[model samples]
Target: MATDPVTDWATDFDHTDDRWAADPFPIWDDLRSACPVARTERYGGAWLPTTHADVTAIANDSEHFTSRSVIVSGHRPPVELAPAGIAPPISADPPFHAASRRMLLPVFSPQRIAELEPSTRAYCNELLDGVRGRDVVDAAVDYAQHIPVRVIARMLGLPDEDGDRFRGFVEGVIEAVADPREERIETFLGLLHYLSPYIEARQADPQDDVISLLLASDIDGEPLDPLMVVRTIGLLLIAGIDTTWSAIGASIWHLAATPADRRRLVDEPALIPTAIEELLRAYAPVTMARLVKQDVTLAGCPMEAEDWVLLPFPAANRDPAFFDRADEVLLDRSPNRHAAFGLGMHRCAGSHLARMELRVALEEWLRAFPDFSLADGDAVRWSGGQVRGPRTPPVRVAP
Candidate 1:
């Protein structure tokens, strides 16, 4: 049997390419059919998983494919990811991941997130209110970016004023690829220092927020480690904010580009929930990765221990075998079991919270501006192949 040249070409991975941010699905599709599980020359020579089934298998079989390593290569692991990377036998295995995940379950329960709907909607309304009279606005800057940060901050019981500071810190960290190494280190250290006092305050005087809950949580009757608490909070903040912000940007971009689709959504406002699922499926803002814990064969390919596997979720969501007309945005996509929030025990803990935020934001935004389009001469920019979405989506609103 002859090896496919398409697959061979895809094996040459580049984690820091600007082109990947523009359109990775076309490359991912070619790789999935030609080489579902293949090695990549990028990331110290890692394996890349392109198929939906392959990603699901790895995500579910955490014992074989572990999350103990930082999902991405080429950067220092964030302090928050340290505990997650060491998630343990439970982290790697079952019952333990379940048990550890259970500790924070209540915090993100549907009811808890639902309780936040009014506040989330209010925040969206407030942001849009400011731009209501304006002819144009960058959804990324005006709405998509602000809503998540505010929601996360409010959820953490942090002051609203810290939103911009945290945003700066995150932007600095994410844009580290473009900045000098020393500057990146300085930004990370600054973030750590900024978070230090919050960790201390949470310890001294706990509150109703997730951070306090984590700080006060105990596993097997032992209190959670304070450092672990800090790391978890940091991860939740970054994960909840950045990925969703980009997703919001992408979803809006999609709606603006497709007039009929936007019209359908605007007319049947009830479709917002379904639209959220479709948006997530079509524009998965986050790309994830895992490490091979031991030598294993997947889709006839032998993966060695310590090999990194990049799970391109956006690509998987568009798999034709799993979805019909996968590229088209079908607002009411029933049985849409996309991997947008991931799968298995390590699934995103804040999935429900994120959904609620999106639902409210979309419902409110469409109602306010049904005739919106991308601003003239403005193009969308994206970064981080491992984690990506539109960097800037300038949109013009019409009355």
Candidate 2:
């Protein structure tokens, strides 16, 4: 994906560009002051809202914006997919979104997520145990990337060995956002083919996992459509893996680079949770996309129907208008009102699960390796497109 260098951040912005993928904070900062709602011809005409006010307004406005296809690609999903979009709840709107969301709520509630802490911690430690004697390790590959994939797999009753296949699906859906449209569609179809059997098996013999839960669930006394169940499973597998791993990797990268932050966590493990919030604010991984339902003027910019509107929650989280010292990561920052999870109807349902993984990931990493730093600052690699974080964050683990 060799994209032309961004000549102007306001006029023609490409999220898949290497520059945005590497460090989008400065670009967002520059646009926030110059152009709050930047326009771009890429991705079949899209808008990037950098300010908190604009992002929140668009996220909360379902009438003007459609969640039909949350991922901004060269081609969007058909209009019929509205109400219950590609991946329910996250990509759904109004009437259908609530019921679809409620189905998974109990599984990710605070109590449920709390119950998984011990296992998540054990998994993190297990990852550390693999690299115990090594002087260097790719935290993203060796640790951060594995936790969520394993957890989500167990929850969905997918085999742990299928982690590699699941990661391939994640990369196809998320990292390859700028690929050819035909290729992208094929990737999605492949995911459906892979998941159909497992869904069928769950239907035959129900289990305690999410797939069985969804299979057993119904809307207004009607069983869910098989396709919808597969789509939801795909959603859990894809969305669940990339976002949290990115957050975990980026958090570890931050600690490795900034020793002060690392030491603080190593000494006062109590601050890990607070630090996780600030880290999520500073290095928010997910950015959602919405399709313009009708012609609308936002922040003096005219957006036509079917246009792509990128709700950059990460940008909104770092907006100066929204928070004091927004660019700086304050571990003890009180009243942190960040849109890292998102805002309004489409907020992440797995937020509690994400927090638990992140908190436990950091806590265990610190406990195992009290001190660590980047092996080579230039070696860090970030995934392109809406989801942003280090893909190869190699760090030197202390003895």
Candidate 3:
């Protein structure tokens, strides 16, 4: 609880602290009860919304709150990467966002995602097969991390060999808050360099990949801008990899620790889907940002133009006002309107693909280790800022 000498508001909202990183819910629980919209002095000064309604309101009222820099630290694109600072639909607002999303809609449409489900399932089984005989497995690194990276690589049309590096770049970009500036920018440059050739190849020889789809998309009367294509791919790469991976990892971590939940899923596989949703609600793990575009009073808190506000969707998922037993994980909880994938216009474009990946990953993991628990000696360590999940979740599988 580091106090902001200047604001004196987020006196207890130090996101970089080890305690907060280890377990933020307790801190968020306090804030939701005390101040639903608490101000934080960290990350160059910003406001955080904890309650489900307030977070939802901030997400929905984009007119008052812009989506230019979706990070509380604020988006500062290196001159070294691409000409454009941040990519669209994620970085752009309203009409521009709508137009950009229209171009990307084809790539993430329900039908397109449905077509990829079987292959995603096969990939999951293949990943699990490599570690089935082992007594110990890292549900985070070994399983959860692998699913989304490969799924995203296939969509980006990157060669199979590039998946590992793809995952690294995603981590580097998403974890930039606490990471070194040089390292993070270098990762951005790395992504650009890797995509440069692919973007060029797509222009010359368009194929079935997302690049080609973007190249073919039209805005108004003409083809979508080529620069926009590159920017959109960049956004997709970051969004596609981390958001689902964190969700999947959190789900696995929860099940590994709770035998009753694990047994229920294993015994009645039919409940897996709803169970997944319940886990998603209970362990939702994304916190995005929006720049204040106009003066607004949200839940009595004053916000000014250009000021940044964080939309911690995970906190919103746990808001007692919206979900019953909000703090507890209900394996088959229903009527859940969780914002795990966000809400309103900027709702996750890759949600269908993400859902398919999570479903497949969980199903295969359970099949491999019907009854698993966190390794006795080691403990689950969580990462904070933007996304939260176990980075090193060691699960023991009994023979």
Candidate 4:
């Protein structure tokens, strides 16, 4: 069997055996400059896109680059966790995706998110209140991780008590690299089973919450299939909880590491929105997967059908071709079209909500403890690939 170099790169990319997760940008930089489109032998002969333009082009052209299943690798994600992986005509292509996105957009619209501001602020303040007198606090666990899960759970009409358990389940699913594949599959199955009753209950008695709304939604005048509803909920849970948690942690870490950036925001509270965008761009939380539906040429390279495309948004955000001083935290980065929320039809529906959460978090933290730093002997680091985030960010409050 002649192995594909692209699949090999993807396999290596997936395992991160080379510790590429620690700093994947460098690898992306090399790929963007040298081999914008390269073959990896790992993902069963899939192609990998590393450059900004290539990724952007593909992400925008959902028609050409379909998103059905795992595009980078032909493997099907376990059925228990299959909603995200299932691609179109229905799952992979537009019009259908566009309609699905529309059904869920209002749930996270700017106006709706504004209504969530008070609660989000309260959550941030409540978390910070716990460590008010303490010298050091694990921001990742104590603060960052809690807000997103709690808020998202509330949005989904789930009880607050389930927040910690749900977070644990998601963490297990995302960080099960060392565990057997069966364990990961079982974990997600358990998650689905656990939520099964809720789905039924919501169906029987729909409410104002996202789950209830989803349960009652119709696509093209057809009631959403139960399986699709479950999958959509699963996607929301993972995206809303994990990505926001990671972003909050990363944002706090970035602030702690660079006191100047913190001070700038502190002095000009109005800069929080710009600061948030810059932070999101600097630390893209989600890795994208797209499938090649047909033979296509991009960035002077050719890709055949079934080629897996991994769009490294984090790397693209840092590309010099698009960003000036891509590494630095420019709080006032205007006209920043970084694909943090992704691009096109399949872009994150909860982005507005995530932005509101982050903005309020930063606001409350700075107001509550203006002078804060990483605790002595405590350093922050990130983990996971498809979902990257802080291992634990420790902050020392200066009272």
Choose the strongest candidate by lDDT.
2
lDDT of 3: 0.78
TM-score of each: 0.90, 0.99, 0.92, 0.89
Winner by TM-score between candidate 4 and candidate 2: 2
Ranking of all candidate structures by their lDDT, best first: 2, 3, 1, 4
lDDT of 1 by residue, 148-260 (tens): 89889988877888778877866765544445557766875786677778889988998888778878787778787776666666666767788788888888888988889
- For model 3, the stretches where C-alpha displacement exceeds 4 angstroms are 1-9, 74-85, 178-184
Name the candidate, 3 or 4, with the larger TM-score value: 3
Residue-wise C-alpha lDDT for candidate 3, range 23-65, written one tens digit per residue: 7788788888877788865665578888888888888886797
What are the Cα lDDT values of the candidates?
A: 0.74, 0.92, 0.78, 0.74
Total backbone collisions for each predicted model: 2, 0, 2, 21
As a TM-score, model 1 comes out at 0.90
- Candidate 2 wrong stretches, greater than 4 Å: none
Ranking by TM-score: 2, 3, 1, 4
Residue 361 CA displacement from its true place in model 2, Å: 0.7
**Residue-by-residue lDDT tens digits, candidate 2, 282-305:** 999999999999999999999999
